[model samples]
Target: MTSNPTSSPDPIPNIATASEAFHTGDELRERWRALMGPLGFSERLLWFAFVDTTGHILPALNQLPLDGPPEPYLADLLMYRLSDVIDGHDVVSVAMLITRPGADAITPWDRGWARLFTTAADLAGVAIEPIFRANAVDLVQVSDPRADGRSVA
Candidate 1:
């Protein structure tokens, strides 16, 4: 029996360059879909909402849940893989919800999340400033139209 190379599988494309080639939100979303391949609605929603006007990072923050648990480091790793898409640019905004004074105090969970975000930012070599808020409602004022676009309401 002859081995068939064509019937095997195609090599995965390099994500760095693939992400750099994205020129719009839709392009980024498509590339993300290609990379993630069968993700959940939350994951898809996160990627779609985070791509910026130029199809880059800042927009991604808008997709994360302000009050939910931290996503695994893999998600951050994937974001870092797209570093070329926002290298040397001011991209990524980390926002935290604070309900009261001194509510921004760091906890074990916060430390873990910080490590993920910081590590991803370092690997990506981009700016990811943290924004602390007094409440979840504060984020509503800065809502993304693209995020709203996905809303059925």
Candidate 2:
């Protein structure tokens, strides 16, 4: 039988055992580096925070899945898990501030949290400044300060 050049089978490599998988720190860094390539800056920062704080974010992420919507409790749990790393003293406060307010307006909380997260990411050397600036522009445009009973009108 002739093997077609375009029909190569997928290569399966040896997988790490459960105990080996849970080995944190440098091991986790290696896994993350392999999983998320060089351009995955945000993920790398989060992984660093996870490794620094509790040596693992995989357990929390594992509780979720690759498919479907994450449970509400999972979001809460994630926020709690990231609290220290994000330096967010009040997760509920932060959450409440960012939720949608109406059809066309970006809430103050959204801006606040963006600023906070962006600041934290900058301090962590995550190079998220451009993302933050883009979002800030979007928020300003969506809210339309002049239309929000502001003196700018």
Candidate 3:
């Protein structure tokens, strides 16, 4: 902790000290959503991932609809998990279509998503410009990425 004029301090690693910001942010968003409740965000949105020739992954906005929610949905819920599925190939872009909240409310919930996508691009060592159209609240109150069989009571 040298503040001497002749010495400099080490730069804080990661974006905006966001090394742990993603998870902290996710928790914050979850709590915010819970606090706002009915006055906040919608329940569902669209999610799409694109894969390049090499099988690299990038999520994108796809109008094409699948038969239903992703399999093993854990009670019809969409897992916002992408870290494990977006590498080793040629991913181009990812799109998450969020539903507009009834009001003009924009929370920091976007931070986590930003972190995930940014990390992917960083690892891939490419510059990516993301286009955002819309997004919905990721969930009501479940914080665990793999928490299964939830009961809304």
Which residue segments of model 1 deviate by more than 4 Å?
Answer: 1-61, 65-72, 87-105, 131-153
**Pick by TM-score: which candidate is best?**
1
RMSD of 1: 16.3
Task: Using lDDT, rank the candidates from best to worst.
Answer: 1, 3, 2
Q: Is candidate 2 or candidate 3 better by TM-score?
A: 3
lDDT of 1 by residue, 48-117 (tens): 2233434343323234442455566654765565565543344332222212122223444444454555
Lowest-lDDT window of 10 residues in candidate 2?
128-137
Candidate 1, residue 81: Cα displacement in angstroms equals 4.9
The regions of model 3 sitting more than 4 angstroms off are 1-41, 49-91, 124-153
TM-score of each: 0.33, 0.23, 0.28
Determine the backbone clash count of candidate 3.
10
TM-score of 3: 0.28
Model 3, C-alpha of 24: deviation from truth (Å): 32
* Prediction 1 TM-score vs. true: 0.33
Every model's Cα RMSD, please? Answer: 16.3, 16.2, 15.5
- State the C-alpha lDDT per candidate: 0.36, 0.28, 0.33
